[model samples]
Target chain A: MPAPKKFSRDQLASAALELADEKGLDALSMRALAARLGTGPMTLYNYVDGRDELESLVIEAVVRHAAYPPRPAADWREEVRTLAESYWTTIRRHPQVVPLIVARRTTDEPTLEFGERMLEALARSGRSGRELLVAFRLVVGFIIGFAQGEAGAQAFSPAGGTADEVIQRGRTLPAERYPRVVEIATASARGDRAEEFRAGLDLLVAGLSAGARPASA
Target chain B: MPAPKKFSRDQLASAALELADEKGLDALSMRALAARLGTGPMTLYNYVDGRDELESLVIEAVVRHAAYPPRPAADWREEVRTLAESYWTTIRRHPQVVPLIVARRTTDEPTLEFGERMLEALARSGRSGRELLVAFRLVVGFIIGFAQGEAGAQAFSPAGGTADEVIQRGRTLPAERYPRVVEIATASARGDRAEEFRAGLDLLVAGLSAGARPASA
Candidate 1:
């Protein structure tokens, strides 16, 4: 008989995740993962098909770490808020994975479970068919997009520093040219991020209220 | 006097953008860009500091191509939709740049111009200070995030194909477990993306209507 497998898929996934988390997604490859695992690349084929499956595994590993609420909230909005927050927290822990998650749609159990739960809550909002789908897309877009904004702000902004530093820079911009941007930036800098996220989430839920009609449509 | 410059900043920026657009962002470098320009890396350095500045220039090149509305809409909502659509059109042409735009905060003139116009429209919503800031973030988050979702769906989804194909896959998913996801997939497959984006945008605007308040403190 063939020798028993040495590593669990979870174990292989975690190793791959570590490689990506440290060196970035581009640094991940079967050869690299094998090197990290102290094995040859050929040995890895026994577990994964190639880079695509490897990426999915990495996403699965990262998502599996999220601690979802023990029970769904009775209110659909609240359920969305809870799930969104849980997802935000989870992604924050693995900021490097944001691009991968945003770029690829994985069929991984953990990722799908998150989507299923959020969709369940959205369905409860009394929207069905195309409306339900749009709502789902909106929320998903916000959750992932919001994460991108925050992560980008932290990683990319040359002015990315303490809120105080950011606010200070905002105050210094030429008022005539960027009046609104300056004002919003200064004020937003003073506000708590958690509060901002909550407010934004509330806006999405409120916008979907029964009476509101699509302005463009 | 130093030799006359052979390339304008715009020309250099275009060459770099083409490099990134044709190859992935990772393929862009001083050496490579210079080679494309039929010059040495030192000559290229005279125009740009390095990859960071090169990237900013590339973004500027792309954003400059976006033709903003000659005039802002009379209503704040309409203004937002117009600007959002214009920005969307420009970025969709360069889908590869989405990650760069998302990860880095650029102060390029065109990028800032886009932000300034959007902020001006948002300000007309009558939100001020912290409220205005939150509202701006909400809109910006949605705009960028929604784009990411669409781009990702097109580029990364294994089911990234015709609506009918996606719907067919949705139909085959185990209904008992992914009922809501399956439902959304089937219904959303038939809807127009433009309509979906508009509806999602409307949801955010309506959610921010005067009477609605935050559910969480």
Candidate 2:
């Protein structure tokens, strides 16, 4: 009975992103998004065809807003690291969208644009052909994978403490059976997600630096 | 009605895994698993507590049977590679379970046992404390993350071909806008997934080797 809301495509996506962020990805449906927008499911169709379109909209909104540096750094490594950190910070804020982003392949303008910048940074390292593709994928994989790894660690931290806490409780396990686990857990009771993420990123960057030579020194 | 079918714990897990393998993870439910087993939902309760147990069972079954080398390789890098490949091959077979395994946290005996071996291999590199933990997590993350990336590529490959097909399609984009993407797509139309996977793994191993030093060496 009320007047229908006139929402732009970005507005629709922003609302959908908000829903997924607050309630988790599963809760983002046509009806739910419409209700959030103060509209009806039928009205929702005026924008998106269905779940696929809704998902794409949310994905684009997330990737588009990533705070890429104003320009690429002179050093390819720094460029890759800066761009990667930008992506990590963006996706980390919306944990619910992590799995969705990982699983759903999108050719949306925002994602493609991000990829172009990323590949451009890697190419600066003198990587060509498959090596370049592999490096690019490696960086992308690490960003998403590390996030998933952190999530898994949190899930395993039954007491809702740091991952080391999981290892701490795990210390009760017979040491003979899990010597390395106990040792690491005892030594690593302190945990920092960001530090750990950076450490892994450093390993990849260091490896890329060592393995692939620049076209000319 | 026919009498209820008798199944062991492993049998129950196997059937659930099969259901997930055939019908995707969403198809894995108490009722669906029960139906797969020629039983009723109530009967499934006798085996698994519910969805969580069912998921745990599937993950364990997949991880338990990984073809880990009989003894740790002489070189720590080789040891890590062997274990990671074992995990990669095992999980790659059951593509549906990749996300489930990545997302779910578990301390079941088999999963713990696998972790113990992995950490042991990593510890051999003299990466103690948090460094060891990060390295272990990096390998785990790479395995899962790389698989997710491959799946993403496949999903985006709308023509039902290799990931290059997706790139081929994108070649139509204005060259100036997607110069790097188009260049990579043009030079690298030949896709080899395993080769690409190994290439990424090589980067990680190379990174691990360069970053960590043995206490003795």
Candidate 3:
């Protein structure tokens, strides 16, 4: 075999991410990543301490790409919208990364920085610390949850069915049997995923904003 | 061998639900379900159509248990909260069923009925059909998504490292490296899941209620 190649932590993480993207996260292993980097497994360890560290790095890299624009000093509404969209885009791009994103609890630098910026923006809107924290969790949790559902739809697309096909199936159901589902599914079929995300995000932000408003002086 | 007994579809679905409770949804299969009911796989066909049909039945059964109290004639807020909590309790009882719940389109009869009641409540509150439909979806989607996260915590309870263990690790992170995460994680450690769910649900319901109010007479 040719002399083993040198791999940096970044290189190992990037390779691991690519593997996860291609074959899903469960398929990723230290040996597979090392081989992808053209290094021995032991040599790969010189960079990442273990699977947890490798995972942490991959998540950090993913979040780095999903980072929100610098927090606006005013207009928390726009900031929240931008931040949510950034996260949705990232999850959509790396659909497989989402389960990993949710499963791990990270103390990574970039994710923490992102959290701080979001908290600061919410604080600037004049909410109490507890409210700001709860709002922050709601926004992030909603985006993550919505993205997971969207990803599930993408992953579980039936062999012969599109969203339209499924909606059409609902429409043909006996009216007496499913009047409301048929009605809602018909309307929801025409509902674009992007539009749905925006609508939900707006609803959430509006609630938080209203809650933050000061009582009569 | 004892003569194979005839099995009804309800028996098969009941057995499958039991299997789900015992080993999770992933462990369920036609053979295991048939074995549990003391019948051959072929006999199962007499009651349910296939795996997909059986899954539909299991979901319907679980959802039936989630039914809300009949909608009071015009109180939309109470109606919505009751509906949300009912589904929440269903998910809590059958955590393994969530992926199936989220993936399948609403096709069961009881699920359809539940949708009708929710729509009627929203319609009475004066929102357009489109707004009511969107709000219904947002609520269901949020609950399903939140349950997935909560269920994951239960399913993957940190072996040797509970949330408490993880929080302790958070404390060790340099304040400069992870100020907000450390702060947030510290606070979250003291948080209760039921309280968190109630807060989120209330926020969502309050927001939708505000949006649905008629603008001027």
Candidate 4:
């Protein structure tokens, strides 16, 4: 009899990703993944070394989905904004995968493409050496962190009730104790996530522009 | 014989946190946690509802540990910087648990205290209403995102042989394909974490000040 056909790495990773999206990351165990693929748990190792590699594949696939029109040869600020927004969009789609992206160590071709494009944009900005990289990281950090918070609160924000009632309850927060928090967080939670992201993005770009601009610019 | 005594919720949460920190978040299952506590899994439920409540306790304790000296009555910029730094420190110590903090729906008392203090500081900056919250979220997003990147790179940055050799490998990239990234990401990987954070923080404060900041200051 012919040897049993095996799943490709991408196929396995895709299935795993689907499993994660459908069930949850906790449910994506080896046996569960094998069952999703119609294979034996022991046989699944033929494609993947184990869970760690599996997660890396999922992150790579997820990152690939976050598409942006390449302003790569254009202005540095716009390029950075586009890249950050794309990444932010990815986080919004697969919020569960944010931690996995942050946790995985390996860099695949697709993920590296995003980095390559981003770095090229930063280069056009006149930032070089450590500054360019630091800028890249700083922008990315803000985007991911903000997106995670947004995703985390989703189950509660719109999940709990309408924004008006939510704001009303939040507004009633004790003024004497957490005056700043009562007003700020309550109001903050009320605003739009995309608007906040764009506004913040503008600030970073402006600040970064001022900090790194060469004589020519 | 007398009835079996029970563990306190805090004690069980603490144990769960320890298990998560020691092994990994995935290892902190109900069965495993009960095993760690030297009690039956069913018995473990007496102190906690189940895995969900256990995770909450762990997140609460993790937030509590990310404490600062509380410059609550201090400068707005300084307060934002302090709170971000403390949160960063916590992520560093317990990188594994960052997801739990983000994933948890309800904000516990300790986490709110940090927020209360941060908002108070943001308020002192003459930003209020929604602007105050947007500012708060932006700063936080940057901090958390940066910390996640830092934590993610740990298994490689200091994990690989030496920084010099790693940079040498990084520098080997073709001068034409990615001169900017080669120079930047390579050098960024070499800088101290705190320095990068502070530098990024300054850029953000400057940008934010240039934006929503009041003219009086």
Candidate 5:
């Protein structure tokens, strides 16, 4: 008879990530992962120590997919934008993983590597060590924050509410009470979400560029 | 015998907020709130429609606490700082409410009023209507995002883990591999948490101020 298939830690983590993406994070369990892998739950423990270790492995795998190209020998702006877009794409592709990425405190090797590359890129652009670190965090925090809001919107979406439904609900409020919000909401409703993200990113990059100064030039 | 205490919608919501503050949002329930008020769970329905309504009401109450002062007839920078600080203080006081605030599609009246004042302040500072709205949201989004990170850290701080613990955890990686992260993290640990928040806020404000242009000549 043919030998039975073997499950490696990498394969197990990949399968777990797929399960999280297809179903939600809450639905993920060792039993289910084992079932998917054609192995008993106890056998799966041979690959991963426990759920926490499995989750950490999954996070590391997911983050590795999000890595940027080594910073271009160019302006910090391009480097920051590349890093932001890479990270954003990763979160967008695996919406379920985003929350886990945000919550996990481990300075795991992959994440530290990502941080080091970003810091070097910022430093090469003439930013001080402190400004470089802070700006790197600003971009990371902004993307994660924005992704959280976007993911929540995609998940809930008012249970079938349309853009008009949202705007109509806002308009029900007294115009005198929320004139500006009403006005902005009306305008924003007509606006594209991608455009808004880009605009905010532009402002952030511009603001950071304007603020950047050499610590000891 | 003395009359039983009367319960109002505001009172119920206030009690819920208090419960959330003491325990957490997850622990809040109709039964517990009713018990806190010395009334039956059915009694709460008279004030709030359901769990959803109670949550909405609690958000409104917390937001009311986050209200800013009337738009000061002063420079736009001071006005924006005041608004931002009001927001920061409000979210800090009720960190649990932030996710709800971010998720809700329709903001309460007071929040809208606060937005109008902010828009006016930005307009006075010379931002176009779109710029004003985007910039305001960027600031609000960043503050909410920062607060979430801080709250998450507080919630999951390694038991018996000091700043040194965080540093020691990172030290497992070879210095040659993650020198910059190790350096920045080591330096970051030297500052107090409060100082870190202030420094981040300063970076954001400085970035925004660099982008500001007066609306009126």
Candidate 6:
């Protein structure tokens, strides 16, 4: 056998990330990662317990890169916005990780730290308990939901084409059967999804700040 | 060869759904699906163009079953609410399809019918154009986002245990850096995720009705 290779956990994670970027998330088995690292799968256990832990590390890394290292924040909304925007960009670039991010419960250090920072930022909003958790859910759900929507819309376009095809395809939608859909399709063909996502974000943030809590509760 | 099998597209979609339900979504392939149907992989092409078209049919079926046979609506909110709730339950049960649903831009007949119904419900809210599309995105996003959030939260529990284990695991989080997280975690331990999901949905619907549209918009 070749001399054993040495790699830090970060190095391992970076390698795994590249593998995911290249071959897709489902392709990131410990064996594949080990192969990518020029090492044995058994040796991979030194860094992680199994594929699950390796995935968590991968998720943590993606989230860390997405959140801009989570510095101390002045404005809760701005910080939250920054996190959301970064997440949007990160997911857009690395669509492969979207499923992993969605499916895995992130209990890793970086992700937890990021979560803590989000809660800290929201502390200013004065919603706690169920209200606090729900607020977090709303913002996060919106970001993820928007990203999925944008992805789906983009998938309709031919190569190097705008989402106009999605719109054009809808014009064939019978006017009587789906008037609203056709109209929206027309507007959406020429629409900027990024601008619309920001608008939705603005609305959610305003509403969250407007408060999901009742005074008596 | 054995007598050629004759199955409707719906029948094929149902089989595919069962395959997805049994195996994870990743395990789903034209080859695998054909095996499940006791047919050769080439036979699947007769029903679907390929894996992409097959996935659309699968998504359409899920959307159909989840939305309660797509009956004409009376209460817009109730119908919209039904769509979101059933979507939640369907995805929770068929967790495998979540990524497929997220990644595919579904324009299948059943799925489109459902979309038209959702748009019909939202038309009552008096928002259209980009605002209309954004409203639809918000509601859809919220449902998908909440489902994904709940799924991730449940992942923390030890296998074969209730999600309470996930909340219980949060107690070990250091209190200093994550007071809010710990506090929320403590509350979430005994919390009702379903109730919270419904609450969040109500807020988004209310916000959509309140209007994200400007006078000019």
DockQ of each: 0.50, 0.53, 0.29, 0.45, 0.32, 0.47
lDDT tens digits by residue: candidate 3, B1-217: 9666576666667788889988977688888887887778777887777777778778777887876665354467777777777777886788677656655555566776777777766666676545656676677666766665455422221231444566566556677765655565566567776777777777776777667677412
Question: Higher DockQ: candidate 2 or 6?
Answer: 2
DockQ winner between candidates 1 and 5: 1
- Candidate ranking under DockQ, highest first, comes to 2, 1, 6, 4, 5, 3
Q: Tens digit of lDDT per residue, candidate 5, span B106-217?
A: 3555667677787777666667546665666666666656655445432122231333555555554567878877666655556454555555556666666767673342
| Superior by TM-score: candidate 1 or candidate 6 | 1
Candidate 4 local lDDT, A61-151, one digit each (tens) = 7877878784463566777888888778775787566555544443465665677788777666676766676777777777766765565
Candidate 4 to truth, TM: 0.81
TM-score of chain B of 1: 0.81
Instruction: Provide backbone clash counts, one per model.
Output: 2, 0, 0, 2, 5, 0
Q: Of the candidates shown, which would achieve the greatest lDDT relative to the real structure?
A: 2
For candidate 3, write residues A102-204 as lDDT tens digits: 5444546666666677776666567543455566667766776666545542222223243456566667777786566567667766778788788877888
Query: What value does DockQ give for candidate 2?
Result: 0.53
lDDT of 2 by residue, A1-217 (tens): 9567598898999999999988877799898988888887998788777777788889888888887878888888888888888888887778777767766667788778888999988887778778887887788778877766544433443233344556567667778988877775565456677888888889888878876765712
Runs off by more than 4 Å, candidate 2:
A1-5, A157-175, A182-189, B1-5, B157-175, B183-189, B214-217
Go through the candidates in order and give the C-alpha RMSD of each one to the true structure: 4.7, 3.8, 5.4, 4.5, 5.1, 4.8
Model 6: how far is B135 from its true place, Å?
1.8
Worst 10 residues of 6 chain B by lDDT: B153-162
TM-score of 5: 0.75
Which ranking of candidates, highest TM-score first? 2, 1, 4, 6, 5, 3
* lDDT (Cα) of model 5: 0.66
lDDT of 2 at A80: 82
Query: Tens digit of lDDT per residue, candidate 5, span A5-112?
Result: 487778998999999988877667999988998889998877777887777777777887876775364777777677767767776677676666654444656666
Which numbered prediction scores highest in DockQ against the true structure? 2
Ranking 1 against 5 by TM-score, winner: 1
**Candidate 2 docking class:** medium
Q: Mind sharing the TM-score for model 2?
A: 0.87
Q: In angstroms, give how far residue B197 of model 1 lies from its true place.
A: 1.2
For all candidates in order, the CA lDDT equals: 0.74, 0.76, 0.67, 0.69, 0.66, 0.71
